[model samples]
Target: MPVQKMDVFDVIVSGAGPAGATTALFLARAGKKVLLLDKEKFPRDKICADNKTWKCLDIVKELGLWKQFQKLPKAEIYGVLVASPNGSEMYTPLHEKDIAERGHWYNVKRIHFDNLLAQAAKKEKNITFKEKCAVVKPIYAVHSKTHISGVTYHDAKGKTHDAWARVVVGADGSQSPIAKAVGHSPVVKGRYATNTRAYFENVKGPMDRCELYYLKGICPGYFWIFPVDKKTCNVGIGMRPEDFERQKKSLEQILRETIALPQFKGRFKKAKQVTAFKEWGLSVLGKRRPCAGNGWVLVGDAGTFAMTFSGEGVGPSMRTGKIAAQGIVRALNENDVSARNLKKHYEDALWKILNPEVKGFRWLEFLLLNERLFDFVIAKSAKNKELIEISSRMQHDYTLSKKLVHPKTALKMLLS
Candidate 1:
């Protein structure tokens, strides 16, 4: 179908999740004419574990939303409890200070969390938000199929329109249309993980921290129970695609079996399932392809920046959005929207900041995938207070985490 060109924008961000919303928010705050588009309306449900790390909290604070985030109903996460295949558990506090002093992490439903960000972006004078707008394809420049000039999208009423932009930001997530249109493989099959999540109410023994269980059935992946409130928890499981296919059982079946395990059976005996199972894909950071190209850049899941080990993308996604916005601003100022320019200034710099952590997590995922190694680490951490502390700190501090994947530490861990 022919697309009708509409008003031009300084930047058009596709998708309104954390990445897109953050990108639009930053750009609009800088007085850029930004258009934010999303297929769904605000407060729509998003499939995720719904836990925010310290890094994610920092971005929220950076956006000046920390006070408002705190005002919302959320569960304060203090630490993590990890259970090994052998049922041995290790408890690690997230930080030294209490939630009051340090302002601990949180577990919030994405429906509410995303809406908060969308609302923030909506308030920006330079940001024009269009919900129920689905981006169908990238509009390329005349005589150049490789360079994106804008996007063609369909509104709720099925009206097709084209909006031109100097640079288009692809925050559309794992199944990003922009990434597809640009001929970039958004997710490498081997590096991708499949995840399924559901909400449960009246869950017993709900703790103030998140819990992860590495069972025999799922080695490379783990099951998580993240409490969103006193009565509700986000329960989910994640596994490599190969592992998932090998199991032959559906994710729902795996979830059921996981909850029925000896470790979790009692806690879930009285729990009531509040939502149906929903699934999504995650592309770990290390496996991501080039995020920047002519007249466009991809952020968040669209750029495949989720962590390898934990499949956490919120923090990394938001960070990428901020970086992309900065890069877009620079590119706009210089009037250089070429792929080479954006790639050199934005994509390269993004990987520089994120590569080390991605490599570290990739190593961690490799080690944790081994059942014996995972069991040993969990068992050892259970008895070793220092190791537990280190493990806890690694969740928030990438520099500290690098030590875990070091040759010396790996040898020590294996030998000991």
Candidate 2:
């Protein structure tokens, strides 16, 4: 922990989020020296629905850690209910009566769940976990335009430390320092995304299931009420950055009005706000080249790999981190840590896991914004099982439209 001593690690991971921690866990399992660094301590709170999807469960199971997660306390689910502005409802059941089938998913507190996962990496003997460390700059091997060799960071004591590694992985959040250091910085615009959220405890009025409300003008940006516990839930709204700007009200003010709706009037009357409402920009990935360069690779939000539709990143970040680690392991084994070698594996792994979903979400996003089209789909899907199922897949991938039977119904409606 001394700043005077320069530490050399085989792989240095920045930002101990899902991606970074998973990368460290995999690297340690591979018998490599891994150093995991984070600006904040473990078990931190994040703004999200905190629900792990079926796809996420499958990935966790493949990692051999699914059983452990199953043992944790889980939220009960009857089904998900989608309510449209026109009073139409689409319900999807979460439980499967079939013996061979699994249920949809479970919701948990990120404070507890993320800590548990991060602890898994800490349990590995080869991984060095450091908290309260902010990465200041990436150490480049050649000139500033070349490969990154390591990082210069400041620890909790405000003492600076230089870490040298063959490869560095940036698993930081949307606002990634490593990404900026590597020159793949997020381009923030008022056009792409606007964030607003409020968490509630003791929420009432028939919220046993996840509820999504698609307000008419809000289009692509809907409101979500996700159950966190029997008595606690996260209720918030997200909209296009442009729409949010036009409202001329703070996100908090808008959220207060949203909760005052007829449906939520009595339910959240006594609800407690766990945290103050705030807004942050969502970074929609631009058409950038690969996220990895010589001796450096980016994972999770640092790489702009978040699927914009659902605004969920934890599961994807974990998968991305694991893939980045795998590539590092392969390159290290071959004694070739070139950016090209590591990038090929990282990019392939990311696209395989997320590209389809990203495309699908983008399409849904487009439709959600088309007021007339979105209203038609919502109204039509209210009672149509086929329409409901297809629209649901939009959250997974917008490309589902291309594969849906009778896709013309929605396409023609939207186009018209």
Q: What is the lDDT of residue 46 in candidate 1?
A: 92
Q: Which stretches of candidate 1 lie over 4 Å from their true place?
A: 1-5, 97-102, 405-416
Which residue pairs overlap in candidate 2's backbone?
220-368, 360-397, 360-398, 360-399, 361-398
Number of the predicted model whose TM-score against the real structure is largest? 1
Model 2, total clashes = 5
The sequence of per-residue lDDT tens digits that candidate 1 reaches over residues 8-42 is 99999999999999999988887799999999999
Which digits, one per residue and each the tens of the lDDT, describe model 2 over residues 176-257? 7778876665754522567677678888766556787877656566788888777778778877867767888877777788
lDDT of candidate 1 at residue 176, scale 0 to 100 = 92
In TM-score terms, candidate 1 sits at: 0.94
lDDT per prediction?
0.85, 0.73
- Model 2 root-mean-square deviation: 3.4
C-alpha TM-scores of all predictions: 0.94, 0.89
